[model samples]
Target: MLYPTLRPIRGATLLLTAGLLAACALPRVGPNKSEIFAGSVLREGDAFVLTVDDRVNAIAAVAPALGFSAGFLNAGELGADTIRAGDTLGLTIFENVDDGLLVPTGANATAIEEVQVDAQGFIFVPYAGRVRAEGNSPEALRRVITERLAEQTPDPQVAINRLAGDGATVSVQGAVTAQGVYPIERPTRSLIPMLAAAGGVAVEPDIARVTIQRGDQRAEVFYDDLFASAANDIALRDGDAIVVKSDSRTFTALGATGAQDRITFESRTISAIEALAQVGGLSSTAADPTGVFVFRNEPEEIAEQLVGQDVTGPQRVVYVLDLTRPNGMFMARDFAIRDGDTVYVTEAPFVQFNKTIAALTGSLSAANGVQDATGL
Candidate 1:
């Protein structure tokens, strides 16, 4: 019966065939245009290519393209560099002869102890009584302690050292092997040591951004860049917070390419050439070398930057790269692929034509069979 004939077309293969037929009915994207693209898109020259020099210039600005630099953006005047309340201190008050006051002036007198600075930031001492240890360097505390002892004892000496575990702490959070508020126990010049202590970033350091929040100031920089540039690796301050955010910036690759997927930039920046290599290069047989384009929704001001263009909205900003030409390779070297870019490679015209013929022939054969069965 008619119902039995239709029943044979209700399985997985039939469903797949139906899906393909539906797809074939819609207009496929060509080399020049895309369904998602809009407005009057300028070609390679009209749109900016973004050379290495351009990136260098952009990096020097107040805010860079990929992210912001913490040290460069810090505008607060230099604050007092000292310990805060709740910090700890290790004190050593030495007496060469080991004889003094409570020790009976010769009963072997020596004390080495660690004390927590009270909420008020005061630490108790034998002769100095409760003295302020907060907001003072170890050296500064030593001078104050020595001065306090001079009045009561002869040849008095004092040395103060800030304890790391309970004092001088920095908060490390986000994508890290270990995340917690860790103390700057040892001398920490940059974020590397602190990151190491916390078991480093959860992902590859190259694929993360380290955001440092000091006081009210907040800025972010790529973790790899932070280590590469000495200036970027500024010392961590007390109460400073650091987060290792996964690289959020990404670009898409589609069409006749070795791989088609959303690709996140591993480093601070990457050029179009590098991006192509990352995606396993274009599909050698089916890809049209002349149809490689990078799509972006550019800012309104970009229209002015390009000459002879009727640009409108943020819908269209396409950069075409012709790999077939000799100089095209050179131009590609300077073309920087920004975050959220769509790198598309159109299928070869011959391949598209072959696909169209195949789809049409299959559709005709199915229609004839249906007509024959219906006796029309």
Candidate 2:
């Protein structure tokens, strides 16, 4: 514990010297540049000069391309979910009372039967055989069945109810509480509701990355976007496969920052400015206001455009944002921190020089019996 009584008394000259000494304290050490931004992305003219704009644009465009934009809920409401083959149907044939071929005595004038739609999209009945059942609703199937039986029996009534319809189903797997196939019975049902039906995420998936794979292509969105934007809460179509997995996006904060740690994002997206805030911002004493760099691996397309070559894969790009400028603030705000990014703040160039002077001053003050003004 520090107390006034045990503190060092410093003369004006010594006080100034000690103040300068503290200002020149060593800046925080961070990850090596070669290790963080590894690869040919930084090789001479072959290297593409990447910037924050490139990253933001790539992500902004890619996210929406993967179905992360707005107006999805409205569009989903338009599609009607209909029956398909492999769905089980509860079929009942009814006729006027009195004993008959279709309605036997004490059979209650209703013949209840369970039938499954075949691969050829057909269902068999006692009299109406080989009826097409796929692509038609249960009610529609009942009408079709009724028309087929009308000629066989007078006043033949038919009722069809879905027993086990697994046709309109979405495959929900990976890190979800209930991983299985969930049937989509209503057109109004969207992504969130479908997740709820599958028993919500198993252990809170990374909200920024929930993937949806349809056919050969895949799309992803931030978890919050499903609820925050209607377009992101896209309606599920038949055979839409969803995956809620752990967060893969993370950035490391090093060098002259308030805290040096690998920070993982909880939200779908975070800007470079927001990322700095998460690590408690830059150190006022050690950090150079003009030296803020974001280290990242850019997409190949971006690399090829700037490099003017056929860059096949991810390229290393170091984006430097000068906080000393007024525009830098806006730039940082617009600059997005991507997955596996590293935010580094370099030390001021004069810090080492200042430290050498302060060390000499503090020594002279101590030899002359001048106590430290800061009481250290």
Candidate 3:
């Protein structure tokens, strides 16, 4: 009679323990709506929680625009024929007198095959001394040399011929069909043409980014924009270094997404709906459609616009989308997903409840098996 009484009591105790454990620690993809909202202003949490709406969507859409800056857009034209340092010039000094300087006896003209411009922008002739070669065309440089040689020689005539130059070249590297140093000539004087000289970009045009670094100034623009507007085709300067690369902007898909991974942007800008579709959308069996969230550290300016107040540095923001609502789909369709964001979808409430009931039932079944084994 004692054994019979103890058996039912033991099973009842096991069932109660399992129920308590399941309620306390049910596995979840992430925080539920109540838990996330607990940290809102109404609660003690510091993160700015916002429900997705048209006004919030518009405010958050003001992302950092990726395009050429003023320094790049307002660039002046670069003279294709202008000489620069390290250029190779051919100088021919013609003197009327047979025994004149810079020319062999009986030879009226002296040809100097290669006259390299020094780093200081000066070139040295036999009698003309040092003259500035950079920033002058071949004809302009010839006039300067003639004046210098006229002092000692009678009726001195000078001619300058520009040869193949290595000074006025731009280096193209990164994701391109060809990577090398190319001369800035008639066809390759501007940004777009220079990129074409490298056999165009190796990556997709929609996602390619082209950056131009000239001395201390730097600017970047999308490759597709170069053709979209002619103003974006800024002139290329000497010593300009161009890099063509695939856009590195990415967002992470976590929690109940069909695929949880960091995905690259397929376009220059990605909306919330587009980002979800890229990751195979939410899991049908586990995802809570109402708990879609975007986690980001918004810049101070954008944060102020969203909250309608001043905020310092970057502020923690969590944007929520409830698909159960009528306007939820439209809000998600318009909301922009910025770089370095985490797109998380929480599991449905019923899913966790199901797990708890399963846990409790399993515990009770094990207790019944024990009773049967003991023949009680």
Candidate 4:
């Protein structure tokens, strides 16, 4: 009978040990066992003429007007000018009178507003007939109208009137509240108002990623400085597009890390170590100090391209960094991560097993308690 009792006791001890061992074998699920390098190894600045298909399509969905204009002009032209066709023209005219003598029938008229300019660049005046208005200054247009009307009446009372027709329009696209054409009347229009018309910039407009496309060229501008400084708020020309784009760059931290994750870099640079710190550091118990590994896309290929060389080898390569040493801290700073970098942390074998064992034991204990309460 004593031997039988001893056997049951030993059996219980073995089961407990097995459970703990199984738990130890479980995988680590947090950041302590994993690491993420915080920057893109991919370089975005390189000038590549390759056709951007689906990406361009997605961008167009957010700002359809951009796609329309981009089709008309190359990426480069879109960067500089803001003017586009179908915008209203405003004109001011001063009719010539005998020196300073006012005509008996003369009446002062304000400059015309909303003068419609056809696609052919002709402005229709009520009495003056169709006048070529494209590429002419307001004063020049005033003179042209004055001369034409002079033929009809002596010192024809002509005051260049306000623009009544659409002169040119610029489309505000992407991340704006209302994405549509904005009519330009003056040489200068504030970006805020234009954005307001299209619905102000989309929530959290990638402040650093504003793009202006004119003709074939594309210009990347920072919205913060551009809007803050009056000097930089460049006057918009016809056919210009103000695009508030989405943030393409992002860093994800997942696992047993303290904070778990963070987005956006306050500074231009973020390192693997810095990324870890941003998320509340690593968990000590389940963390495997020696097993820390950072998986990242290979940076050498991009770096090679930046220096101007063709890679004849396979393009598949992933970088692994060991963070066990003090020197590894410097790698985070030296190795620049690009947008879309993912950081992962793994758990230590012992800690993982312990967690699993604890979970199992807790589950069993709860089941036993329930059965006892039910008298089963």
Q: Count the backbone clashes (under 3 Å) in each candidate.
A: 0, 7, 0, 76
Best by TM-score: 3
Q: After superposition, how far is residue 339 of candidate 3 from its true place, in Å?
A: 0.6
Tens-digit per-residue lDDT, 1-376, candidate 4 = 5455443443364476566766564445643422222222244322222111233222211211111233322222112222223546665544455332223335443356677656786777655789886756556677788787666555654444333433456788877767888766542354545666676666564333567776776666555545555544454556778888765556777665675664665444466677777777667765554444444333444524433456543233233444566755555434544455665566667775677668777766765575567554
Which ranges of candidate 4 are over 4 A from the true structure?
1-27, 30-116, 124-130, 146-157, 163-208, 213-219, 224-235, 243-248, 262-268, 289-292, 297-318, 353-376
Candidate 3 residue lDDT tens string, 51-99: 9899999898887777887877887866667789888999888999978
Clashing pairs in 3: none
Alpha carbon lDDT of each predicted model: 0.68, 0.69, 0.86, 0.53
Model 3: worst 10 consecutive residues (lDDT sum): 2-11
The true-versus-predicted C-alpha distance at residue 236 of model 3, in Å, is 1.1
What digit string (tens of lDDT, one per residue) describes model 2 on residues 1-376? 6576544433445666666666765433643334334433455433333444545445423422345434333444423446788888877777775665478777746656668888888988878878887777677778888887887777788877777866667899987778988777673367888888877777555453588876765677656557665567777766778998877768999888899999888666688789999999988887876778876666887656545678688776667677768677887887777777888987666665675666766566564553344335
Query: Cα lDDT for residue 140, model 4?
Result: 69
Which stretch of 10 consecutive residues in model 4 shows the poorest summed lDDT?
Answer: 59-68
Write down the lDDT that model 2 would get: 0.69
TM-scores of all candidate predictions against the true structure:
0.64, 0.64, 0.92, 0.54
RMSD of each: 8.5, 9.9, 2.2, 10.7
lDDT of 2 at 372: 40
Q: What is the lDDT of residue 238 in candidate 3?
A: 80
